[model samples]
Target chain A: MPLPRRLVLTAALAFPALARARDTIPPEARPVPARLLPVPGTVSPELQRLIAAPYPVGWNVTPTDAAGWRQVQVASSAAIEPHMAALAASLRVRVEPSSIAGVPVFIVTPETLPAANRDRLLLHLHGGGYVLYPGLVGVGEAMLMASHGGFSCVSVDYRMPPDHPFPAALNDAIAVWRALTAERDPRRMAIFGSSAGGGLTLATLLRARQDDLPFPAAIAPGTPWCDLTDAGDSLRANAYVDNVLVAPTGWLGGAARLYAAERDLADPLISPIFGDFTGFPPAILTSGTRDLLLSDTVRAHRKLRRAGVTAALQVFEGQSHAQFISPGVPETAEAFGEIAGFLGRHLA
Target chain B: MPLPRRLVLTAALAFPALARARDTIPPEARPVPARLLPVPGTVSPELQRLIAAPYPVGWNVTPTDAAGWRQVQVASSAAIEPHMAALAASLRVRVEPSSIAGVPVFIVTPETLPAANRDRLLLHLHGGGYVLYPGLVGVGEAMLMASHGGFSCVSVDYRMPPDHPFPAALNDAIAVWRALTAERDPRRMAIFGSSAGGGLTLATLLRARQDDLPFPAAIAPGTPWCDLTDAGDSLRANAYVDNVLVAPTGWLGGAARLYAAERDLADPLISPIFGDFTGFPPAILTSGTRDLLLSDTVRAHRKLRRAGVTAALQVFEGQSHAQFISPGVPETAEAFGEIAGFLGRHLA
Candidate 1:
């Protein structure tokens, strides 16, 4: 009746069939699926592509000067607002346009909220390997995060790789931060992101420190791609077990090369694990055991702690990378709840 | 019917009486009842005195001599085996004596277990604040970890602090590890500890790296005091909120100083957060949000990650430090389950 026992019984029954199937397929070809992966009914095609990509290579390869890159970035940005508008309508949150460092930004606040009911502002960067899935694609996830976490969220559509490259995304994040400091109190702020966005979150903090900018009260980098080099053992060891990513050589590693094109891979600005983390704020990082970037999250967490930064790392079992975006999953919801509690403790 | 909701309602009803009792006691005079402390029933007289004393003043306080430290360590070692023996008796596991680097070690193996069964081993260190509660006091916990994890646990009765200070505990752990390398394979091994033992877990890895020893598959540092300087903000911020360890200044801080004695507090062996973590294994660090050393766990996790180490951190809500010893508590059981699950994944 229970899951594990049921699984055991079912596995016993299917052992012979599984063995036959294994014999028919070559080990090297076993990991690749033959059919078109079905998108969850609730997810958009754009998001599906973003999530389904072997690695976020497309984002890194879009040429900065190319017309196609410009069109894709524009299309991506345009695609996001409609999704967010739908989410805002459902959640009853007031979504307003604002400028941070002259860049257009959207501030989503709970409607009719009073000063006593003030919540922390989360500056979020959406994950798409820095090339795709702008703020719009994250509307559902953002709404879920805000409602569950009881915070206002501002999702940024930073410049993507290929065109903008290493510092472009980092620069945009800092500009928006400076704008927030000019208009809002830094004490009421936290930063969060997943995948490439997660890496960007850490990069932003490092940039803020170097530029003498105010740090957010807390940060959450979920399955961050902190090391562009993909030198961690998991990148090799977990290559097949993790179903989401294609493989480091084919996807993530390629994306890294494109993102870091002419930049140094060890530049702390590009790979925050190498940054001087002297004055960063408190942070919480989440990852899964099967994630290729699990090592990156661990490395970043240790670096921050060594620098006297308050930080926590949470790793979920039996999960793939950035599974947090799939809010319908039990693990995703629990992970969000943990983030909410961590933020409440620090931000309160 | 649901337990959490019922408990919340019950707590709400009892709030007024609790407030009244709090008002009757002065803030400084408020004493946490013994029942709320970890392993309250087992607090020895010497441990009480050590915990109650104000910070030792001036240098050359004639710290515990080598013989005195060894005597206390041995006594504490003897104290823990009874509980372990009781657990092994209940689980029908065979307890055997073994020597590791001339130090006596206890191994708990499940009875009638097949040779083909997974060969998982937990190398556990006991908590004592580096001063008290050595090997003997931790048998119950060690046994529980071993049983629940479905593995043979080799618990080391490593030397304590004061007389044995700094590298002494670290060295002893490495020696046990060396002995283990000859006895077992590294692929299915894990290291775990609590409090001072937790610190030793991290310290051991540092020593192992410097000495070119094989790394364990995974590690669990439960409420580890990773920072010898006691400089984490939580020491001051959560001082009163934390029910265990009456005062950080006299309790943990003083204990750390006395344990390290004349050794440099910043030495990587003394404070693992300062170590180069390039060659270490994956780790899982646990703590309660209310624990004074919660920040230490967080910081240590971050440092390990930044050095490209795979690490996971889990913080239990509403828990005191090292609550893992209290297996009756649901949170404790859940924490152990998580540790076991993590170990299973990495070790399998």
Candidate 2:
């Protein structure tokens, strides 16, 4: 008889883990190139630090992190509160938890809001590879949008994998969105996220529309992992070079499997890159050359543009996936500023 | 009988010239990715003016500027004196012509040299795709190094193609290196260049060591065009994305042919990537992500490191080839500052 699916996967992965080098080699530390040097005055030390920052090889290993991610998820939600408090220095925003139609979310609001955007709201989703960021780690991006964007923000602390997987997160997001639309004009709201949250932001929209809810005014899915299937060029081309999402077929892929289980990975609600974006709100996405999902971001932007949706792609230099989280990281600052500016054009 | 070599090359190149779009794309405005959006603080209005600074497309077409490059070369050498005068405002350094052991060179000394590095000198070479940068344009990098690095610089207006090509530029660089080493102890000097100058810097060392001359303390080949043959991945991957050298198969490639002529393309002198870098001095190379020659810089740095040479590769974000010339470009400022710091480590 054919082996069971999980057993087959475990057996296949066991060989690689046993055979592959136990140590990891950072991309920056990876030796050497062709060609002439570039024009002078272009290579800055900041870009150098951003690109050449070294980490242990296999830093993005899925299986290695799978247990940790699940453990964090299983760990008391209160443990992440301090991590959320630490994010205050970078964002300078007020954060407090509240129920959105019974869905728990943190409301993030800047000290002051612009006169034009005083009434507008930003809905944010946090990235954690669909398996991590159990609590306020999920609100890091929301804080950025709230503080940098000068708007009231709501970060969905939606249900997640292991205990709550697949459509649970989607159901929570749609419910919160429905509750949001009940009290506020959808056109005055902008939704955004990065990484897994980025993919969920898009998935939420597909579900929101299916539930007959209206779209938000704009979206900034910063480096969205839109394709759960990992079909983008950078997934392979940038493999080890992008230290964050090291390889397409590794733990991150396995995490997707754990969340997706019986769900078709290609479902428009799962991988939004394959969705029809016609009539969707204008989008502004972000990525970097070293982002393993760079192709996902680029292809999604292209897909949106091809469908006649207004889309803008903002890519940073030398950054890996969700590099925006690094405190005082210049690229992250730029990402937030541009997203806000883009929102200024479309939102209230 | 085979047609005369020149006639055959002309026939082969003419068809593509007559076929291409003929629209030169200013590096920033290339159609591949659009909008005037730049990194927020980094992309100031002035720098924006400098980079997104548009120009006639098809400027890289050889036929369009063949006359211009040659005419500038053929014009009275005195014409460059005025250009040098123009640069004095930017560099605040004295510029004048001098001969060292019968080899002509331009000396660039700063307003004041740092006491720690007062005795040190930087031998410089300018990049012109092995064809252009006929005059003071050759010393732009030298001026930056002088003004920012605080080291007296000697820029080799090395012989280039269409008039002087191949071994001519290499010979000139080597002669200058020898003449300089005779005056300044090689230990207190560093050699540097970008593009063709970058490649020539490497070739100069090869030639100098072959002739038993001592090596400089270190070398900085910024975005050096180390390979004449198009074997690197970036030449194809970044073809149109890098507006400076739009396609390796076009005028840039044609220019290499013009320089190489009958020279074996794979000779270590022509493509230094194939050369043995064992016992080479420590190197610091620069390139940008969008630079078509990025692979070249990465490969060379790796080769040198593998050969036990200390090699540091610095790359910038969003920049095309040679973006350092644009005034007030923050990346340029950082490049010069870091090079000066790198020089301070080894030069004195």
What are the iRMS values of all candidates?
26.2, 28.9
RMSD of 1: 23.1
DockQ of each: 0.02, 0.02
True-structure lDDT of candidate 2 = 0.65
lDDT of 1 by residue, A312-334 (tens): 77765434466555533444556
**Local accuracy of candidate 2 as per-residue lDDT tens digits, A31-102:** 112222221212234433434433322333444344554543443233344455756665688888888978
Q: Model 1 — TM-score against the truth? A: 0.46
Q: Write down the lDDT of every candidate, Cα atoms only.
A: 0.59, 0.65
Query: Could you tell me the lDDT of residue A77 within candidate 1?
Result: 47
Poorest lDDT segment (10 consecutive residues) of candidate 1 chain A: A6-15
Model 2, first chain, TM-score of 0.82
Q: For model 2, what is the alpha-carbon lDDT of residue B145?
A: 81
Candidate 1 chain B, run of 10 with poorest lDDT: B6-15
